[model samples]
Target chain A: MKVVVQEALFDPWEEVRNYQQQNLPRGKHGGSVIFVGTMRDFNEGVDGISRMYLDHYPGMTEKHIERVCEDAMNEWDIMDAYVVHRVGEINPDEPIVLVAVWSRHRAMAFDACRFIINDLKHRAPFWKREQRPEGEHWVEGNTADERAARIAS
Target chain B: MKVSVKYFANMRDRMGRADETVELDEGATVASLWAKVSDEPMPENTLIAVNMEYTNTEEALKDGDEVAFFPPVTGG
Candidate 1:
């Protein structure tokens, strides 16, 4: 399992390809599931969001994401999981996060990938402040993920 | 006893600062520490992390502990 918190823009496909080439064994994994979350042009019923400032608790944010990835590996039969999340200022259509899971079977890969992304969405120690046309506002909350909520409860 | 308190996002904005060291009575819990710092009651869905681990207001505080307060997470 690997987790990276960075400020620079990343190519999701390149990250997946490189990680699989360097880390995964030959022919050992049968499937890989990848999920990329990107910044939207609009949010919370607002339009033309010019930019977003992503703030995080330096040490705690990285640790929280690492724990999320570890939890996913523990709950599923996945070979490996790599997560990369961007921090600091971001523009619309930029990738916010990447989650890739490799497993011997597709079912495990799918389950673990979803689990990691959902956990990051609801639990990670990152906050968003959007610069809309009106003014800057802190995002009150994330889009509700019932799966994450169920797991939390 | 004394503890370091850190605020993030909206909490930081509302508090008008990032972090500060606050003195607390011995055996003070997270709830009382928050009450000492802010006048408003803890907002709904507020998140608390003690020493970087998620915890509740009822969790007890200790000298040199790091406590963080922020709104609900909104990240991918």
Candidate 2:
């Protein structure tokens, strides 16, 4: 299990390769599921998002992510899970976060990956502010009701 | 008692500082601490954490605790 929080951009494919090389020798992982979250040029129908600034409570961010991944691992039959989130200023089209899970079967891998991403979205401590041509604005968060509705759908 | 209060994102911008130490009565809760710090109304959906854990406004605070307040998380 590994959780990383940094200001530098990371290569998702390289991260996966590194994880496989480091952990495959220890245990057998038949399948791997990965999710890469990227910054977009628009949000909530607004356009021209040139840059995004991500801020996190340093010590707490990593701990929260680790806890989320740990919960997923405990609930599912998975070998390992990894999460990496970027802080500082990021441009559109750059990756923001990555979540990967390894399991003996495809089913567990898929479910665990999804669970980690969803939980991270709702539970993590990172905040985002968007910079655009008009002005900079802090993006509002998804309310619990909205999250519940999304999960139900 | 004293608690280290930290602000992030817009909270920091609005407060014009990243962190500070505030004196409080013994056993003050997050809600009262927030009231003591900012004069304006707390933003809707604001999130609070105590000692690196997600906590509620009613949670009792301890001396030397690190309290963080910020807007709701918007990250993926």
TM-scores, each model vs. reference = 0.95, 0.93
Writing each residue's lDDT as its tens digit, candidate 2 over A1-153 gives 999998998999899999889876555778999999999999878889999998888989899988888888899999999888999999999999999999998999998898888778887888898997789988877434465568799
lDDT of 2 by residue, B1-76 (tens): 9999999988899899999999999979999998999998788778889999888899999899999988878788
Give the runs in model 2 whose Cα sits over 4 Å from its true position.
A142-153
State the interface C-alpha RMSD of candidate 1.
Answer: 0.6
lDDT of 1: 0.93
Per-residue C-alpha lDDT of model 1 across residues A1-153, encoded as one tens digit per residue:
899999999999999999999999999999999999999989879999999999999999999988988888888999999999999999999999999999999999998998888888888999999999999999987888776679879
DockQ of 2: 0.80
**Measured by C-alpha RMSD in angstroms, how accurate is candidate 2?**
2.2
How large a fraction of the reference contact set does each model reproduce?
0.92, 0.80
Cα lDDT, model 2, residue B41: 76
